[model samples]
Target: MNNPKFEIFKAKNGEFYFRFKAGNGKIIIISEGYVGKPSCVNGIDSVKRNAPNDNRYERTDKTDDYRFNLKAENGQVIARSSEGYTTKVNRENAIDVVKKEAPNAPTEDQTV
Candidate 1:
């Protein structure tokens, strides 16, 4: 099985962001842009430390789809899953995958 991975890139707006991708290369979650690369790395660290905890997940529904946020201990949203899960179970499974995959995921710099 392929391990999940995090890709870091410089956005067009010149900010840095990281995206967590599943083993098959599907992006499972994306993070907010940061002004500096160090901050973006910190965000990745936050996800690694926080994604495994059930309490750090905040679930919500948007119209017909379910979405969730991974939050840090201080309540900042570290990353957010893409919307469109039709059921709560699927959304929870997505979160579970993040919990399972994030800790050992490798980081790739795609800023070039």
Candidate 2:
């Protein structure tokens, strides 16, 4: 079975970001771009620390889809859903998966 992991990569803009992928290889959560890789890694650490808290999730429903943001205790948005879900159930499921996977997910340094 594929293991859920955090992949850190550098964007073309020279910023770094990290994405949490589920065991199925679907990206569930992605951090905002950081100017440095260390900051991006810290973002991933924050996600692992905050993901299990239900209150940290800020859910939204747009006209066509549902989305969510994972926030740190300081109220900073650590990560956001990779894509809007077509249904509320799907969005919740994605959040649940992140909560379950993030804490133990190993980091894959793709920034090399």
Q: Highest TM-score, which number?
A: 2
Task: Give the clashing residue pairs of candidate 1, or none.
Answer: none
Candidate 1 displacement at residue 69 in angstroms: 0.4
lDDT of 2: 0.94
- Per-residue C-alpha lDDT of model 2 across residues 9-97, encoded as one tens digit per residue: 98899999999999999999988999988888889999999999999999999876999999999998999999999999999999999
Candidate 1 per-residue lDDT, tens place, 26-77, comes to 7889999999999999999999999889999999987669999999999999
TM-score of each: 0.93, 0.97
In model 2, the Cα lDDT at residue 67 comes to 98
Query: Any runs in candidate 2 off by more than 4 Å, and if so which?
Result: none
Regions more than 4 Å wrong, model 1: none
